[model samples]
Target: SWLLQVGPEGYIVLPSAGTLEVAGRTLADVRLDVLHRLSALFRGVNIDVRLGRPRTFRIYLTGQVKAPGALQVTGSPRVSDILNSAALQDNASRRHIQVVHPDGSRELTDVERFVRIGDQSMNPWLRDGDVLQVPVANEFVWAEGAFGRPGQIELGLNDSLLTLFRLAGDPLPAAEVGNVLMLHWKDPFKPDSTWLRLDDVYRGTTNPPLRDGDRIYVYYIPQYHLQHEATVVGEVERPGTYPIAEGRNRISDLVKAAHGFLPTADLTSIRVHRLNPGAGEKDPELDRLLRLSRDQLTASEYVKLTTKLSSLREDYRIDWARLQESPKDLDLLLKDGDVVRVERLVPSIRIDGEVRHPGILTFQRGLRIQDYVQQAGGFTDRAWASRIRVTRVVTGQTLPARNVRALDPGDFVWIPERPDKTAWDDSREILTALAQVATVLIAIKSVK
Candidate 1:
């Protein structure tokens, strides 16, 4: 076996054997000449002669073909063979396959005619750089609204409503199977629509064929009642709005659906902000106070009235702790537009300095400075009880421990180191030393 190259002059130049002129010779002539020459040199020996490097050409088959691209051919290939290689798509036009030649000339071939009638004229050999385009079928329709898989679906030349419905995955459960609307867009601004009963079409009563650019919208059954939905936010594993089904979908159920609360969630008081339907309704006593003549009352009385009015507008806070204690309250039904927020636990108070087990302790109501000091294993020997301070989180005020009644959340409890002497005692000792030095100076002057 040897490799050979055909020259630009259309002849193969062989190095081992003398060059055989094949410019005008056919492929059979070249093979026969090689075999005869080998047989003459070695008599009664088997010889195998094969042609190599036939003139290669490429042609492109695009649009609605299974695999559209340039196809390389060693020899002239027929249109049927090229189309078979490309594997035309289902929506490809069978009667309008166009072949555009490199010389700007075009030819239309009916592939279906060639396949059925064996018309050799419709299956001409492809030329180099020819572009074969298989256009998509013009009859296509879009199916949207209440269909399982709704989108623009290409249709066959004679596809009916039944075929289009099956392609769109049929009508969904919520779809009104009795009424289906088909809109034909003959004009861009105006579209003609027709209502067809899908139930009738299913029973083989009347199946209408669809045209190109037709849109089929399946209507849904009308819903008269409202569907409830609630949202849960903050300190939960999954926080989002969830639809409340028609059942016992209470606060606990909503919380469980959100994958429960996080570790840092404050179980003490979970806030549920509800929007009341009668929020516009006012209390008679509050309305009376607003209408009262403020100019007739003294300045102090008017201030008291204003304070009472402001307090009346305050939102009521639900005690989640009490609700958690009562089993019946946990099953309380939730309403639509309700926002349940699980607040994060407050940070523990920091207690560092002279103490046996100095660290932070979880905040609790009614915890005092002494209680926190005792919880930290009491104070050390050098602990200065008089210099103990508390930094309040509310006002950000660092005051003496005696001034604070209770330890608030996020408060810093500090105990300073005990001093050996008081400031007044050090000042008195300095004054005594200065007096002794002055007396010593006066006695020396008297001796002089």
Candidate 2:
């Protein structure tokens, strides 16, 4: 019989054929080192290991082993000793026994199976130099870092090694402290969800759970104020500024604010001028002056002018019958925040009976009879319109009006409704009367 065993003194071997006995400490240490190294090779292989009471187990050794089987171990016997003991009991193949580990790992061994050795039970996954680990039952405490998070930690009965991380990078521009966010997997226990305020986080008051795959997110907040308002000018009772409520600052609103247009307002010829953007003050003023002077530009030209003004302020536009027409027809919308202006056309009387084409005349400062007659389309053929009869409405008096007679804004002149006769008798009489009056005035002036 061949005997294989290791005691306090070391390994002792009894040879199979010869009565030769071998004993040595170095030999035993080397044997143990080899066994441990072999175990490491199978570190992660799955092995059916029964953690029995004290020192017993019904272990299944399989996968990667030539002869896989189940065996009952007892009395602090190592796996190596179990295989060797099985060899002594049956015709077990010594080369078939192997070590298997948790990670589907395995290792082949050629050492004699039937051997009695004492040290400690081998952890097939740990190498000879590797420290053997005993799992110390830990209390279910809050664990953090790479392992457990802040809210729920797993406390070991003794101590443990865990990896951890920290808050990094610069704070984003919009991130608010009150609602700092963590975009992570939803906790199954808290379906309602949870969030942490920045104050709590900064003060370390709240220990929000930060698991392995957790990330923090930051967001921004919104802001609001009053945006825009307008002014009224020209032909109004009380032209001034007023508050512009939302969706209420239109042309009609401006007119209403200004107490409506005055009685002298030219409903058909109303003009609204606005400051033109990209146009210098001098240029816009000059343009307006030119339009006022010419007064006969096409609607297109007027539209262009309005567009120029609109560019400066979107609220400026013509606020009369013209505005009712299309913008192409020189009408435009009044923009909010614009100054509204109304211009009153000059008022004057018309002359007709003996004029070329009795037309309306415009009144100017200090306008005389000759100027008014000339502006009223001049005199007709063989008609003495210049020899006018000025009647006073209040006194009902007729004055012998002359060419240089000064007229008021609403005064009238009768060109003596020409008499229809074969001879020019009445016409001559009217002219002679006017001539006599002119001569008298000249004589009086000469005396003075």
Candidate 3:
């Protein structure tokens, strides 16, 4: 739609509503007036007044603002509405934003206070024909460590440690408020450092006024790095992250702490996944072996490479049954960020490709590859039975028929098929027969 601009003289002229004073008034207040003015003429009508478009006006942007000129702005915008990190000059003071009214009266607003605490008073509505500016900040105090907002903060009038903390969005729970370190730069040459308890500042016991070039460090309380913990998820009674003691706690301890496994939990298939494993640790031999190609590797090197790739990875297959029998030997000792995944029971082996009834068969102990193939209704005519491969679920390794002696419970047997001969293969065979016949005729003629 159409726009009704709020004139500089503090009113919006309408055809029906006449002239309504919109300055210093919300849209709701203006809308109510329109309803009252229209009700006097019409018997009963629905009056829906929506903000079609915001009015535009120019304001003086002087001082330390990046663009210190007359800037055109629309709508009833606040101080922060027109300001961003990029809009300010490098050393511009955000806390001390000066707004000079048309009457030559000044009002100070802290842009950071509004952002940190959401105090509407700190971010006032912009008026037309006002001089807005942010002075070059000469006094700044730095805050670091466990604060919600930690950086260089512009010092303001009557600013204390409380003001600094408030402007910094308060200290984190891990902050050592009992001992806050401050570096005072009273003299340009070197500096004086002191430690003060924040509790004393709150109690009005020791609150010294902060100065320019002062850097305060809010140290985090020790042990904030966290202890060794493991996360147990999926099919567990209580799925969550639980802290563990390195030598004392085992897989069983973690399971007990989690209130044991759920009814659907596959105890046979539970795994302990260590975080990163031996990341950042150097293994020259292993690294060299892993980088080498298959043909470049020796027999011993290939064995080492395969072992490292499979056995030395992040996840470890747990022997939950063996752990129960011999807890001291089989129970895994979990470290920090270790994840214990427990999945639901799946009691069938899958037979795929070149089989008449290629589907899942109920897993049985002491079953071989042939037994699984028999269960899947033998094989199709095109089946390459000799080149069969079995995939073990426990180790997730695909083994050839020669390497794989017997099938495991959760093994997947894949019987591949022979590819059909194309038209090119038939043509090549006929061309070879013709060339052989021509060669024999030439040989016979030479003999004659």
Candidate 4:
């Protein structure tokens, strides 16, 4: 084991060769002496000697590299190796790199050439206490939106749209190559704009020149332009606005685009609400309502008239029955802003009053009042089946149970409780009936 120390003159002192005599020597000389002594001591025997820590030296890595600092590197490291460790920035200039020595001597390293041509001479071994300065290249244009690597890109003197696209890592899939916009600022406030077709540029049909400070914007493809867009809302598997391409633009297409109808969707009635071309046209009926005096009509009547007029002005609704009967009618082209509404299926009918299971039952077609009653475990013992009433949902009219052959969705069936009467109750009922008859005769005489 041999010990080594640095002298005040910045040199290492170690035992000379294999002898005990100490002498100051350069790092290269010390390694050579040790190798010679080791070979002589053991002929044809390879020995692995671990080299101790080398003299600490600092190098400044500034400009266009990540983590610019006074880096401490041991032994002689090549310029390429140092840059690899420091990590070059995206905009770093690899072609015109400079190494400034402590004694003010300068050396140019063409790192780009070394990287491309593998010319080791271009990436010379770095000397201790050297300053590695990377210069930034000039002439750049900004690329924004829908580009893989969008930012400021360096351009050559004769660079064009082709060069810019390549430097920006090309357009993304969502980019609209046919609608790229380029803007050149003439001054701080004035800009000259030009629309470009990158598809044509890429095809070499045109090569538009790009100048410094010019901004290139790649537009994303619009949903409508890429496909005919129609909106489907309510009671569908996935209800939302959908796009239908050239061969796919139809009513069926829109339905498929919406992922089909849900189980709760009303298949019998689908409404297509279209944007009316005459929407801006004034209606004479609405004008008439507007001219009416508010004092002449009650507040409720005025509101009703206004709402009815508004509905008449809106887009017309097409029934789903027409489309269902003729599926080919689905071939009808869907325009932009057209809204297709699939109504939700009506819920079950309600059955209350004296029944074994008095609750709601699922609505089915051609269901009679007795059918619902049967579903509810039949009428209770006290139920007056003859006095049962059926309420219509649309008309809100209560009719006799026997008159209703089938029940509509949302209809209510009610069974009344039977009246229990005694002999005294019969006498009181006869007296009440006579009093009603006497009052009716008196009212008729007064009207006459």
Highest-TM-score candidate: 3
TM match of model 2 to true structure: 0.24
**Per-residue lDDT of model 4, residues 86-187, tens digit only:** 488877877568999988998877664455436676687777789999878665679999888899865544567887777677888989867888898778
Q: For candidate 1, give the lDDT of residue 225.
A: 52
Q: In candidate 1, where is summed lDDT lowest over 10 consecutive residues?
A: 310-319
Using lDDT as the yardstick, the better of models 1 and 3 is 3
Of 1 and 4, the candidate ranking higher by TM-score: 1
Per-residue C-alpha lDDT of model 3 across residues 119-174, encoded as one tens digit per residue: 67767778878888788777888889888999988887777877788788788889
Off by over 4 Å in 4: 1-140, 144-163, 171-182, 186-189, 192-212, 217-322, 326-364, 368-448
Q: Please give, for residues 49-146, the per-residue lDDT of candidate 1 as tens digits.
A: 67655678889989889988998877657778778624988678765678999998998766654554465666777788999989976655899988
Q: Quote the lDDT for 217 in model 1.
A: 92
lDDT of 1 at 432: 97
Best by lDDT: 3
**TM-score of each model, paired residue for residue:** 0.39, 0.24, 0.64, 0.39
TM-score, candidate 1, is 0.39
* Total clashes in model 3, counting residue pairs 3 or more apart in sequence or in different chains: 0
Q: What is the full ranking by lDDT, best candidate first?
A: 3, 1, 4, 2
TM-score for predicted model 4 compared with the true structure: 0.39
**How far out, in Å, is residue 261 in model 4?**
12
Q: Positional deviation of 394 in candidate 1, in angstroms? A: 14
